[model samples]
Target: MKKIALLSFLMVFLFSCGQQAKKSETKSEDTPKEVVVMSVDQVLEQASDLAEKEIAVKGTVMHVCQQGGQRCFLMGSNEDITIRVEAGEKIGAFSQEQMGSELEITGVLKEVLTDADAHNPGAEHGEAEHEEDAETQDAHKVLAENQAAAERVFFIEGVTVKEL
Candidate 1:
């Protein structure tokens, strides 16, 4: 009888241990993972794959849109790259004072498709219209100059922003 009682207690202890382990597993699964913080250049380089993903990034505020104070531009530490970040409703508008200040921003990275015509309007028509008119030519020139601009353009939908 004593042996049977000991065995039953051990079984209960084992079962409770298993239950606790399962609970811990579920708790860990429910918790959100930490976001990796990156610089503007790193985010830009990985923009295609990182699009629509939430991430944390640090950069110096280069410019803030004055109209309604809704958006601001951030530049990498080396000043090699810049990215746009729109302020979230929770955080409200970004003040002009934030410009030139290093900021740590947590947000969702987004990619906006550039206008197809802006990239190559003539190509869609074919080689027959090789000689684009002055206006068209001017537009093409502007587009060519800003070719990298579109590819590098990424907006961070700001979740939080703080000076660092």
Candidate 2:
């Protein structure tokens, strides 16, 4: 009957369409993974969590180091929020021409103790030290606390730069 013919035709059409869909979709290991790019504000907000990790940030170039183009600062929507980007071995230097230009920079986040924190290694943190006999870690505990307390500068060591 026509009903049986119609059902068979419908099943055949559905199977053919499914085969085409499978052929159209493909996954290759050689394909590069997509990187999650953060804004300047996000980078500053998540500085501690993102430290030592490679990150991509988009912002407007606020200023560039003039001496030898070693570094540059990126400004977020909030003028107070700015992240420093330093030239890595790959980047020779940030040019003055980048000033006011919007850019997406990829780099590894790094933090260093400030001069004030460096002056006093073991300032006041006493309880953080766990080892009783091995007492040399007092400075390490205090320095870790100081670094956690925002007494350090967070900068990104630039790996690549793209102007957008």
Best by TM-score: 1
Name the best candidate (by lDDT): 1
Cα lDDT tens digits, model 1, 1-164, are: 99999999999999999999999999999998988899898998898899999999999998999897799989986656789898979769999989889999998998776773346765667868466589987877787777756554679999998898
Model 2 weakest 10-residue run by lDDT: 125-134
Name the lDDT of candidate 1.
0.86
Cα error, candidate 1, residue 101 (Å): 1.9
Once model 1 is optimally superposed onto the true structure by TM-score, how far is the C-alpha of residue 33 displaced, in angstroms? 1.3
Return the lDDT, model 1, position 107: 89
Query: Local error of candidate 1 at 15, Å?
Result: 2.5
Alpha carbon lDDT at 140, candidate 2: 63
Counted clashes in each candidate structure: 0, 0
Per-residue C-alpha lDDT of model 2 across residues 76-114, encoded as one tens digit per residue: 997788999998789889899999999999989988767
Q: Which sections of candidate 2 miss by over 4 Å?
A: 1-28, 114-150
Cα-based TM-score, every candidate: 0.69, 0.63
**Steric clash count of candidate 1:** 0
Clashing pairs in 2: none
